[model samples]
Target chain A: MSKIAVIGLGSMGYGMAQSCLRAGHDTWGVDINADAMARFAAEGGRAGALPADLDIAMIVVLNAAQTEAVLFGETGIVADLPKGAVVIACATVPPEFALKMQERCAKAGVLYLDAPISGGSVKAANGQLSIMASGSAQAFAAARPALDATAETVFELGDSAGAGSAMKAVNQLLAGVHIATMAEALTFGMTQGVTPDKFVEVISKCAGSSWMLENRAPHIVDGDYTPRSSVNIWPKDLGIVLDIAKSAQFSAPITAVALQQFVAAAGMGFGGEDDAAVAKVYARNAGLTLPGEDA
Target chain B: MSKIAVIGLGSMGYGMAQSCLRAGHDTWGVDINADAMARFAAEGGRAGALPADLDIAMIVVLNAAQTEAVLFGETGIVADLPKGAVVIACATVPPEFALKMQERCAKAGVLYLDAPISGGSVKAANGQLSIMASGSAQAFAAARPALDATAETVFELGDSAGAGSAMKAVNQLLAGVHIATMAEALTFGMTQGVTPDKFVEVISKCAGSSWMLENRAPHIVDGDYTPRSSVNIWPKDLGIVLDIAKSAQFSAPITAVALQQFVAAAGMGFGGEDDAAVAKVYARNAGLTLPGEDA
Candidate 1:
């Protein structure tokens, strides 16, 4: 019923494009990678330049820079979008950046929604992601079709741009730190002869566990570092958090320490592996063999 | 109906003593503070010095030092306990320290059960605590009555002294880090204009959440600092974690960073306040007012 374009056809974007198509929307998928574009086209997504009469432009790029490049860069889409159309930005950018983007979009007669998403790749493919969204009422009305197609939960955070991104930063702060800390505790337990399997078995029921612990510990238990969310994500996400903390003069020591661990994991060449592979850093440091790492 | 003595009639110990009495045991409550002992006595607990013929002695003291003083120091009770009796040590102590106590008790022909408890003061009162316990088969057999009386979940970790304490350390490592991290995330949310109430509501449903967040965030939302668990407990517990990590040559930066926040909270004279009051340190740094604090 709606004409939609999903920019930056990464793991999340490609799935979101599929969800739009599944909902019977006229969907266009755009990516720098030719393979991704070809794959989306093979999956029945439209492959041409987005039609100017698009109802929604879902930006699922990596960061503010990529988001801006897509919306306001050379061959910018927002200026090309018809009046009253909505641009849903799904990058984990700062609240200030989101607000600024909203202001710029408003000046161009384009509605912008701060709509950073969660629930990861699998959920994205299943049309079951959670969206933290805040924008004008008109923007919400315009973006409804895409939202209804993609999200299982939509937290309407506020009536403006900054609040949704603010909440996203808060979630990222906790998520990144928890993932690294799970690695720390799992590996620390290993030193005491608590195997990864036992760590998952017992701690999951104890007061010590977190959502990240229950979700990611199995990766270490199986020695599977396939990047559900890669080691590279923490540096970028926690960096956004630290930057926001710096701007707010907030001291987040635990977040800082967690950032260092992720950086260390990346430094050790595990950047492309699953974020749970942060445990491999601890495993190596303590000379312990993680599951599947035994020689 | 086993004859048992519970040392240290503090909040946790008193509840444990009541649980023992409720289980039809002849439970003796002892404390340096006569008021605590008298209070438990008024609640149907036996009031007297521990009888030497005590079949089991449960030491529910505060720390490694207190556990040591109560068991082996001047007027040490381990020597006074009857031969073949069991001592269920319910203090959070280093695995090495638990092993040492087990050895000392063995020399006196006594059984020692390394039994560190969880579930806090409320669970203790309800006889629903989780006990992480290890020792010989005889020690488990002898302490079975007390375990049944006081614990709803008893983790029989191993038939040795160190494993129980080691498991407790692992739990504490996860737990202490979690509490501090919850405070960190909640306060970070505040800096982003996310109210304490909203932070609790939203994060509790997200992957960012932990058991500690659900348990402690309400105290912040209500602005109450009643000492469910004191800020001082973290420095002590996380210090034990850091010490163990050091011994294992395991680097625990996140735990180390979290420990510093609690140390700061303690240094700011909030050592007596509830552990949730660590948010005060964040609030002060960011010039944000928490729900219960004076702006």
Candidate 2:
């Protein structure tokens, strides 16, 4: 079994850390939150200090800034890793930032795998996350054990760092826009007297349906805004997408408009609520009450 | 056999007319185009003047204006129909317009079924179209025979005229946005080196997918924009959506953005091309050549 360190014991990272432990890896869970680290330790995970012969450092942090800090900051773990060790970056970061990280890792005689994950926290715990991965063959070979334990599908996008992150940005573009569009359609239906329940019932079977719609619309139907994925995610994720598009001179007008809706939702203090709560922005604008709202 | 007249024998109407004929209705196909009329006549459809004893006048025209023209304009058929005969209006119209037509038809002692259809022309021919219907019980009873002939599922929305049209508007809002978002995502993937074929294979199975993505991405992969549903349909359909949204004072920013993409596609002279050709707008904007284009 490989010695694996999973930094950032948030929803996705904690599940991934558990998956590694379940797969018989000598797994370590690291987080700023002491309670999360203690919880992982209770669940047969190593909690304190880095192992000298770490095989894989799976960074499942939030974004580029956090990922960079966890990797190369003053008290970073990259300096603590042995030669030939792989750093599996599982953050949704810009492709250019991923490339730069790979270069820095190379200079330090460390392998870097650009691995942005999908399928959310539940899938991560079940070891069924989809990992969009790219790096050198050596990095792939080094990261294989951790990947096998954590991912159901690993899309080997290219023999480099940037491609996987690029694909992830593309996915975020679609996924973010789809959630907002679902909100727009559902609330627009409300204005026309189609209830949230009926909107979910009919549209889920129709060509109007998306993976985001089918998955998220039911949350609106149930009037549960508990953040499976929060409204705050879109501004960050779609912000990365639009930034990438801007760098490439790509005109993503739909993505732009969708980003605005998420921003509106965030501005309305629904940022921490479920992304389905974007429908509240529409409901408020049209003066219609959603399923569980007071009129 | 019920005596039925299907006006505007275009792709959807012609197939619906054929479905009626197949169901053993004495169906009369009417169109301004002589070729369409001749074709339907060869397919066992009556190509002639309206039968005065018409039990069902199914107006499968384009929009609100055309539907109004066919039912109440110069040389209208509503005055020609027998009293108690039903006018099964199968066009995507404003709910208000539908209620207006229903009220007007009531004055002429005719029942009106506000029926807006879904599923494409293929489903239309196979008599498996989904009909969103609402009207009085008398109208439902009168239109039942024609509905059974042409629709696999008839959603009886309400005991009035507006609900069916309202649902149709909701469906169109989601459908239109999903299509444009698919193009946006696919083209964005192209900018990231994900080929059109790989996109269909991967994204179709991912949370990024929509029903439109799975259905229309193949047309792009094959480089065939053969107008299964033309780009021209969106400006009309989404225009109707925005109109309805405006009436309710609903802000549909995502739908508004998607509508602009289709309008751009139409302005790019791909109005007659498959709605999938909205990808062309993204491709052009990004300087990316899609598969089957001379790069």
Candidate 3:
């Protein structure tokens, strides 16, 4: 078993750390929250300092900034990581940012794998996440233990850094827009006398359905806004997408409109709620009450 | 066997007429295009005027105007249709328009089934389309033979006229947004060095995928613009959606945005091409070349 360190014990990272331990790795959990680190240690995660011979350091922070801060801040772990240890970056970051991180890791005699994960926290805990990864041959080899521990599907995109992140951006573009579109459609259906339950029941079988629609629409149907994934995610992830699109002179009008909806949801104080709560933005705008709401 | 007339023998109607014939119905094919009528007659469809004893008159026309014209305009078939015969309207018209048609049909001593179909020409020919249908008990019972002949899945939306059309609008909202968003995302990926083949290869298996993306993105990948469904279909369908939303005072910004993209595509003269050619709007705006396009 390899020695692995998973930094940032958020919903995704904490579960990933548990998966590493379950896979018989000498796993270490590091987080800004002492409670999270202590919780991991109680679950048999190795406490205190990370092993000097760590095989992989997974950065599962929120966005590119947090990822950089975790890897290169004053107390960054890269300085002391072993030469061949791989840093598996599992955040949705810009392709250029991923390339820069790979270069910096390489200069420090460390390997870097650009890995942005899909499937959510439940899958993360179950070791069934899908990983879009690209890196050098050595980097893949070094990161395999954590990958096998955490992911059910690993898409080996290319033998470089940015392809994985680029693919991830493309995915985020669709996924983010799909969730917002699902809300828009569901509420629009409400305006037309199609109830949320009927919307889920029928559309799920129709040509109109998407993975996001199927996964998230039911949450709206139940009026449960508990954040399986929150509304705030789209603004950040789609922000990365639009930023990259701007640099490339790409016009993503649907994505732009979708981002505005998420931003509106956030502005309405539903940022921490499940992304499906985006239907609330539509609900409020159209003067319709969703399921489980005070009509 | 039910005596049936399938009006407006376009791509969808022609196939549906063939399906009805295959199911042993005495089906007539009617269209302004005499060539389509002649073609249907050569394929064993009944020739000459619709039977006076017609049990079902399936109006598979283009829009509300065509549907209305077929039902109640000068020399319209509804006037002569038997009192017990069902009129299955299979066009994508507004829900409110459907209610009006149902009321008119009731006044004419005719039964109305607000039955709008899904799946495309191939499914129509195969007798495997999904039909979103609603009407009174008499209407459904009268329309059963035609529904059985033409549809694989029949969604019995409600025992009323407008619900089927409402559900169809909901489905169309998602369907239309998905196609345009597929184009937007596919072209967005191209700008980031994710080739069309790779985009399809990866995204189809990821959470980003939709039925439209899987079905339509390949058309982009192959650079084929032959209209399985045309770009022009969106402006009309979404136009109906926005019109309905406006009457309800519902704001559908993303759909509004998606509609603009299709309008732009039509503006760019790709209206008659495959709906996937909406990617061309994105390609031109981003200055990115799609597969099979001259770079």
User: Which candidate wins on TM-score?
Assistant: 3
What are the models' TM-scores?
A: 0.98, 0.97, 0.99
- The collision pairs in model 2 are none
* Total colliding residue pairs, candidate 2: 0
Q: Is candidate 2 or candidate 3 better by DockQ?
A: 3
Q: Candidate 3 residues B164-229, lDDT tens each?
A: 999998888899999999988888887778889999999999999999999999999898999988
> lDDT tens digits, residues A91-122, model 3?
99999999999999999999999999999899
Which one is best on lDDT? 3
lDDT of 1 at A91: 96
Question: Chain B TM-score for each model?
Answer: 0.98, 0.99, 0.98
> How many angstroms is residue A247 displaced in model 1 relative to the true structure, after the best TM-score fit?
1.2
- What is candidate 3's CAPRI-style docking category based on DockQ? high
DockQ of each: 0.81, 0.80, 0.90
Model 3's number of clashes is 0
Model 2 stretches with alpha carbons more than 4 Å out: none
Candidate 2 lDDT tens digits, B188-245? 8887778888888777777888889899999999999998899999999999999998
lDDT of 1 by residue, A1-295 (tens): 9999999899899889999999999999999999999999999998998887889999999999999999999988988999999999999999999999999999999999999999898888889999999999999999999999999999999999999999999999988988988899989888887778878887888888899999999999998999888999899999999999999999898999899889999999999999999998888898889889865
